[model samples]
Every structure is written in structure tokens, then in C-alpha cells.
Target: MRILLSILLVLLFVPDWSGEPRLPLLPDAAAFRVEQVVLDRRDPARTKLGGLTYLGGVELHGPGPAFGGFSAMMVEGERFTLLSDGGNIVSFVMGGDWTPRAVRFAALPAGPGRGWHKRERDSESLTRDPATGQLWVGFERANEIWRYAPGFAAAQAHSAPPAMVKWSSNGGAEAMVRLRDGRFVVLAEDRRGSVKGTVRGLAFNSDPVKAPRHGFTFSYRPSRGFKPTDMAELPDGRIAILNRRFAVSSAFTAALTLVPRAAIRPGAVVTGREIARFESPVRHDNFEALAVVREGRDTILWIASDDNQWPAQRSLLLKFRLDI
Candidate 1:
């Protein structure tokens, strides 16, 4: 009876993977610019876009299979890392000359293997702990969290929040980011029968096993029926959210910016209204990663997509100059 009840509860509120009442796309704002989407899948000597700064190029190798379907990315200054759902890691270093020509790419070790744990493992989101430089990875299907030391040399899995595991795979984490205070914030894929994924802001004390107390919560809404992919906090504390299309309109492209940091909290209620959406002229798929890079006075927003192993899809990295 308990299992049946839980399934019923999820069906009632969780955003149907099947198409349902679609949310209309909100009016477009002007805070972002999508410079280019690179479609080449080959291990390139150099992957260069038309107008953006070269972030370096990477070629990945593996014992069994190299990770494909490249998705999200995280950048700190001249250094950046890329995550592929196929479970591969790539790293790059920027050149000192400061032109697009100066950057160089280097491949890093592969992420922890799928069979390493009991869960049905697939990497979704990646975030670096600011102080420790540890990388936290969110896994789908099996619904687990793993922390890896620098260079993916060793990893330790953590028990998830009790509420999250009880909710089953539907409540598995989607994205994670470390707070200024050293606590980590996690995004739940779905909760209480709404497509709105839950944001969990938790503090990591000396112990890493348990997550206590709710930090913040936010749900996603599709403008003209789009789903949010990932989020990043700006220097001033506002959030920039990446959105992608699913189901009938799964190829739409848009984003939301200017979300005040004060608005995201536990048990706090907020909607897409606090979000200002970005309108781009290109189509996007599973725009699963985002990072903010500042060069002097200008702050650039970096966006990447998960190709889902489809030939029609492209491993795309796009750059936008923030007007705010």
C-alpha cells in the first residue's frame, strides 16, 4: 500500500514525462547573446567557434569507450572542465596571449565508472567546492551523489538526503552548487507532482554523510513550454537559469536571468515571474551546464548542451555577454 500510494502521489503532481498542458514561452529579454553552436563530434585538434574566445580544445580517450553526448561545463578563470553524460571528463587551459589562438586543450581522466556503485549511474551535473576544490557529481537513475578529489583520482559516494531517496528516482538530484558560506545547494529533479524541480540548499559541516535543513526551493516553468536545464549565480547574487525544450517542443531555446538571490529559500514560494527570460535565435538541446566568466569589466555567460548520443544533435558551447 505504501508503494502504491507513493506512485500515485508522483503521478498526480510530477510533470509528466509525457506532454501535458504546455506553459507558454514568456516574452524575450535582451541580457544574453548566443554567439555560436559547434556541431563537430570528432575528437578535434581544435574546436573553434566563429566569434567567441577560444576556451581551449579537448580530446578524450578511454579504455572501453570515450564519453559522448557532451553536456555541461564549469570554468574558473582561464581553466575550464567539461562533463559528458557518457561519463567522460575534459580539461583545458587558456593561453596567455589573450587571442582566440592562444588557448590549448588537454584531456583529463574519465569520471567514476557506472558499475562502481549500485545505482544506474549517469552523470548529469558538476560543481566544484570553492575551498576544497573537490568536485561533486550528481547521478541520475540510481539517485546518488559522489565527491571526487581533484583530477578524478578517487571518489567517495555519500548517502543522499532522506527525503530525496524516499521519493525514489523522480526526486534524484539534477544540479549542485556550493554557497559562499560553504554549504552546498542541490536541485531536485521533481517533487510533489510538479515539473518544478526542488532546490535544496544544505550546509556541509565536518560530516559529509547527511544533509540537514532545507536551504531554498524553486520550480521550473517553460515559456511557450520549455523546461529549465541548469542554473548559475552571478557575482552580485542574481541567478541565471538555462532552459531547454522537451517533448513536442524539445528543441526550443531560452533562458531566465536577474533572479534575486534573496528569493530562493526553503519553503519559500516563488514563480517564473521573478525570472527574466533570454531569447536566442538558435535551437538548443539539454542545455545542461552554465558558468560565469569575468574578463576585466565584462562578465560572459557560458552555456553547453547534452547531445544525447543523437547524430542530429551537436555538442554545443555558447557564450553570452551579460548586459547587467
Candidate 2:
């Protein structure tokens, strides 16, 4: 029976989702690995940082199917939580030696759709509230934001704000940050509202989902032809934004800009001052994720790149100390 054989094959290869539980699945102990790499091949110990100092970096690799595509990240001391574009979550602890330990991998307990296709789960941005430990994720295709409980145990709420409904399918919310003053800022990856080089931004007073209708509009200007990828707030209330550009020959390049707090007023267009640029002689890729941590008098910056799950590209994680 040809029909019977086809049915059997489908049952053997497809995972059962009818009774799937709400908890995340644990990955194998040896699923993830990391190898150190120098930012500059010539020196191997020094890197070009316009206003920062390079600490170290590594190339991440794994044998699992959903290992790469990390577009956003959250860091708490030595613990790191990364979210992939495929809607998978990878969390691990890295010691001073750059070795990853206690690695755990899982899928989002809930997403915008049924997780049937890659577009249905194209999560692009992430932000966390330090006071509450709550996490917020931005999905690109659906153009919505979902809030997860601490530890990502469950999805508590989600929203598809009217302002973000018109964003491009693949260019929806790409960067987000919860400011220290309890305000939330979200930046679109593409230009909107008749603006050529400017992207749309939204600021919320409280939780985005709860106060979805209570927000104001603003504009963000990235480098020409570049798009905002990620943002992190500094200890002194300024914000740093990462913008990326891709070309056929040059592959990829990135820029870091700093925005003053006073320039973030509602209904205003804000442009950040370029602080650093990544180009040739400096190892760079699709650097999309950013996070900042303060250690006494030093400001530590962490950046991660998305390999796009391609063989030719490598996942990169870099650290630098901002010199103010």
C-alpha cells in the first residue's frame, strides 16, 4: 500500500504537537561549543576600538539544528541568554576562561503563531526589565511583542500595537530597551512615515502590552543605508545603538552610536553621534545583539553576531570596555 507507507513515514519523522507540554526541552550536554578568536589576525592580541578597549572574543559552534541565528541577547554577569531568529533560546554560563558551562537550550513556550514555519517564529529583538526580571521579545513577521515570565517559564502577555502594524514583514521591531526611568523604547528596522533615512520609534510609559495605546512616536537616524540592530543603555542614562550594513563584496560592517538622554523627547527626531566603526582588518560579521554591564568604574560592552545558519559564516561573540 503506497498510501500506507507515506503515512508511516510522516509519523516517524514528525514530532507530535497535539499534547506538547508548556515546558522547554533540554538540549544535550555536548550540544554547544566555543573557540577563542582574535579580532585582528595580524596582531592576534589587539583590536581597533575607536573609543573602547578590546577584551576578548570567541567563535561559537554547535552540532544542534537550532544552534545559530542568535539575533538578540541578555547578560547577567557570567550567565548569558541568547535568542535565535528561529525562536529558540540558548542559555549558558561562561567562566573567565571563555568556556561555556551549564548550557541549556529550549524553544519559546509560546510564540506569535503555531511555530509551523520560520517566518512564524522570526524573533528579532529582546529586552529585559531589571527590577521585575521580566523579558520582552519582538517578533518580525507578526510585528508583535511578547512578554515572558522570569526564567522564560511562560508567556504572560503579548501585543500587536497599531503603530507597528505597517512595518515591513522582515523589518519590524529590531531593537528595544527598557530605560532606567521605567520607559520602554522600540525602534523599527526599516524607514516609515515618509522618512527616507529615518526609522520609526515608539516610547511607552509602562508595560508595552498593558499600555499599548499609550505611547508616543519618534524617529531614529542610523548611518546611511544602515538599519538599527540593537541598543543598550549606559549607566549615565545615555544609549548606545548598533547599526549594520551588508554588501556583496565587503560582506558586513557595523557602527556604534551614542545618543544623549536629553535628545529622546517625544515627537522629535534623534540622531546618535558615531562613536566606533567596524571595517576591514577588524573581524566583523552580522553583529546584531548588544548588552552593557557596569563593573565599578568600568563599562563593559558585549556584542554577538548572527551567522544566519550559513556554513560560510561563523558565530562571533565579542567583549569591549567603553572608555567613556
Candidate 3:
């Protein structure tokens, strides 16, 4: 009996032989290759406030309402899909020359913020289900996510937290991504409670015809000053996050970090790794959104900045090819 008890204790305390911690995930002085940094040269430029530009190639696309506001972006190979946040999810596809293909649009049914108290629609971040190529849009004001299909008219809204409804006016559902599986992970731009500016990663599943379910919840407290705007999982399962600094202070700069995937599970309290910092040349605007793409076996990280309709601030697109 004594020998059996000792063996059990050993099994309980021994480190799992199958797993090892990943360290030094990112190198210091990480060199980010500069791609074409395009300016939103459009007529009536004064009101053409452009934000969040994504580069598929020379086209250098972004979100604008008039000349192309609500023109949000998502990429698949040489083809890129840019959508309008307010309109019926009008999709403008861009191909080889970066010129947009025919426009495909869709609409959504009247629901939570639909009729009387309809919130202004501001789609912030976009992610695709790797398995199905289904599109998910996270709104900045409404604090909601909508799943859409091609050539459709209306989208199916999903269930979001009360915080989304509360912070809809500001930046609500800011950053989100779908896992290899069907579940999703999202982060709020800011909080109203003691944990204001706190980041929560949630995992849930949803269908285009139905609302999403909140399966798990985990909160991550970054270094006091940083706020994550986007997140993606590495091939090996480590989580990579993009941090944005709103204020133009000396300490404000964009950052990239890697954290163990296990550390960010729902209901689990976790922390992240400070792998790289992205600081543009003197006058670049605030970097807001990020997306990861795969070229063959190579992983590429793309970043876009939001020009708050300021002439002095030009929209910027930066790229980094990950070594590991």
C-alpha cells in the first residue's frame, strides 16, 4: 500500500513528458519588410477618412465610405475581399492588378440593434474560418459579430456580451479570429469596469444561420499600457497578439507578442510575451489591424494603420515574414 501511494504521488508531481515550453519565439530587432505604403488619394479627401489598409499587392486597399468607406479587407491568395460595414456587406473583390472585381453585397435582418435603437455600423476586424472560408465581421460600435456568405443579402447576427451593447458607441467588438475548428476568439477594445482596457479572449461556435454561443472566457492583462487590437494562433499553437497604443505619447507604439495557447483558454487567467515592437517612421499613423497569411509554407504577418482622416497622417501597410 505504501509503495502504491508513493507511485501515485510521483505521477501527480512529475511534469508531463510530452510537452515542452516554447521560449524565444521572436527575435530582437525584428526586421519588418516595408511594402508599398499607399496614401488614400481620393477626391473630396477632406471627408475621405481612411482607416485600416490591407495590401494584397499594389492595390493597397482600406476602409472608406464615400470613395469607399466601409471598405474593410480580407485576403485569400491573390484575391482580396473588401466589404462595406454599413451597406449590405457589399464585397469588392481585388485580383492580380489590385483592381476590384465585381461587387457582391448582402444585408442583415432586424435584430438587437436593428430597428429603433440601431447603432451606427462600424466593422472593425475581419477573420475567416480556415476550414470553410466563411467570413466573420466584428463591429466596432455595435459590439457584435455577423457571419456572411457570398452573393447573400442579409447576415446572421450572433449573441454578444452585454459589454458589447454597453460599449457600442466607442469601440465594441474590436479584434477577433476563428480557430482551425469552428470556435471563435474575440477581444473587446475597452472595458467599463475596474478592468477598463482589459482584453478578454473568448471561444465559441456559430453558424451563418444562427447566433454564436459563448463557450469559454479568458482574460489577459497586458503590460499596463498596451491594448491588443488583433490576435492569431501560430502553427505550433502559440498565440500571437498585436497591441496598439492610442495616445501619441513616447511610450505608445505597436507591439507583437507570443503566449502559450494554454495560457489563454476561457476562464483561464493568462499573460502574453513581448516578442516584437512595430514603430513606424516619424509620421506614420496609428497601426490598428493585423492579419496573418500563409504563402506556401511561409507565414507572413500583415499590419495596417488607421488614418483618422488627417492629411498629415497617411495610411500605412507593413509586412513581416515570420522565420518561425
Best by TM-score: 2
TM-score of each: 0.66, 0.92, 0.65
lDDT of 1 by residue, 52-74 (tens): 33343222222222334454578
* Cα lDDT computed for each candidate against the true fold: 0.52, 0.85, 0.53
What TM value does model 1 have? 0.66
Q: Mark the regions of model 2 whose C-alpha exceeds 4 Å error after superposition.
A: 4-27
Candidate 3: residue 76 Cα off by (Å): 0.7
lDDT of 2 by residue, 129-210 (tens): 8888999999998999999999899999999988899889989989998898888889998846335678998888887888
Selected candidate, larger lDDT, 1 vs 3: 3
Flag regions of model 1 displaced more than 4 Å.
1-67, 94-119, 166-171, 192-224, 247-252, 272-280
Worst 10 residues of 1 by lDDT: 24-33
Best lDDT among the predictions, by candidate number:
2
Backbone clashes per model, in order? 11, 0, 10
User: What would you estimate as the lDDT of candidate 3?
Assistant: 0.53
Q: Which is superior by lDDT, 1 or 2?
A: 2
After the best TM-score superposition of candidate 2, give how far the Cα of residue 205 lies from its true spot, in angstroms: 1.3
- Model 3, 196-260: lDDT tens digits are 54565566654422535446666766655777777776666666777777565553367677767
Candidate 3: deviation at residue 108, Å?
8.5
